[model samples]
Target: MKINKLLILAALPMIGLTANAQDKGPQKNDFTVAATVSYNNTVMQNAAVGTLPSYNGFQAQSTNWNDKSLQVGIEGGWFFLDEWKLVLGGGMSITKHPGYSGVPGSADSDESFEWGDVPSYGAVADQNFVQFNVYTGVDRYFKTKVDGLYLYAGARVGYAYGRNISFTDDEYNMGKSVGEAFNVRGALTGGVEYYITDGLFVGAQVDPFAYTYNRSLIKPQEGLSNLDANSHNYSILAAPTIKIGFKF
Candidate 1:
């Protein structure tokens, strides 16, 4: 009888442990890593207005676009708290612009000039840009009705360095540094994710506001020498991204 009672006591503890494990539910995942690709058609734009001494009372306006910028990056996060995560990421971007042609002349005048008019003179006639950025942020995830669906809000601070080079010909080696900039920015981010499987998911995110300070360095050109290398310029911008991730 005593041996049977001892066996009962041992089995009772095992049963209690199983019941406790069931009541606690499945373990939550605490870490995630992701890769993202983003595109921005109008990352930057600028317009300039001026008057030329040769054209009496004439005003000229010029516009520029930094179109079709592409970025690829990776991000990783640790959920230190139940619903809060610490995130870090880094990326590189490339932007290209169409080649520039000299301003068209009036139909009445036969005098027209190309950008390569002067010997040994070069203009950033066609530009290509490359940039790198790194950031750290905090994210909060919310519970949702559907299993494997997640939503998050985050904020990040980052620094970026970029350069734009102009090439004289199709060979990119014949190029000169036309412009460069260093920037620091802070952003507010929000996103949604849906996990197709327990460990993999797809998502999209947007930065509604990014406050930035930019310091620019640009080469001098004919008739336009007003660029300041030590100026403090501020801008507000937004960025959107699509990503795929894995959680473990």
Candidate 2:
């Protein structure tokens, strides 16, 4: 009888563990990692206005912090509570614009290009951009009626650095045009995730909207003076991204 009682006591703990393992809910100390990426060739609408003047050789240009065409990111989070997570992540973005024709032989004075008013004398004009960002945030998750489905909302704040370069035809002998920009950004994020199986999930997320403050310094060619500009802007932006995540 004592042997049977011992066996039952040992099995009780295993039975409890099995029951706990079957519960597929977020728990304290659970860690998760996820990836987000997107690609599109479409031009951005409502790009930030440039600090430099629009000229034949120099087009008005600025960083569009919300542009997502060229983006790749990875994030990881720790569940401090069953319903709340602390997350950290970073991303990179890039854009390219090509083939701008400048006015013929209009820029004759040094001051013309300095104020960004010089007419272009080159046949080839283009601009390219790249940006990097890192962020941290907290997310709150809520369980729905359906099993393995959770809805989440969060807020994030991050810093971004962006670089843009304008190119003119070599024959024009114009100075290089480059703009270096920085942004302080914040956004609200929300998403729905459906766990395909325990510890694995697929979901979609979007920022819904965001605000950014931008500062840009323009070097409009080696000879011309540098320009400083700042802007405060709010944009209605929703960039939806698919996600795959694992929890342990």
Each candidate's TM vs. the true structure?
0.52, 0.60
Please, what are the lDDT tens digits per residue for candidate 2 over residues 10-57?
999999876664576677999989886642212221222223355433
For candidate 1, lDDT tens digit of each residue in 1-248?
99999999989989987665333211235688999877432222121111112222222111111233666678898888877889887767787876643443333333554554543222335667787767899988876776667788989887767666654442322333355566566778888888766567798988766665656545433345434343332323356789988878
Question: Can you tell me which runs of candidate 1 are displaced by over 4 Å?
Answer: 1-29, 40-68, 92-131, 163-179, 219-237
Error of 1 at 236 (Å): 8.5
Per-model tally of clashing residue pairs: 0, 0
Pairs of residues clashing in candidate 2: none
Residue 120, candidate 2: alpha-carbon lDDT: 53
Model 1 lDDT-worst window of ten? 57-66
lDDT of 2 at 37: 65
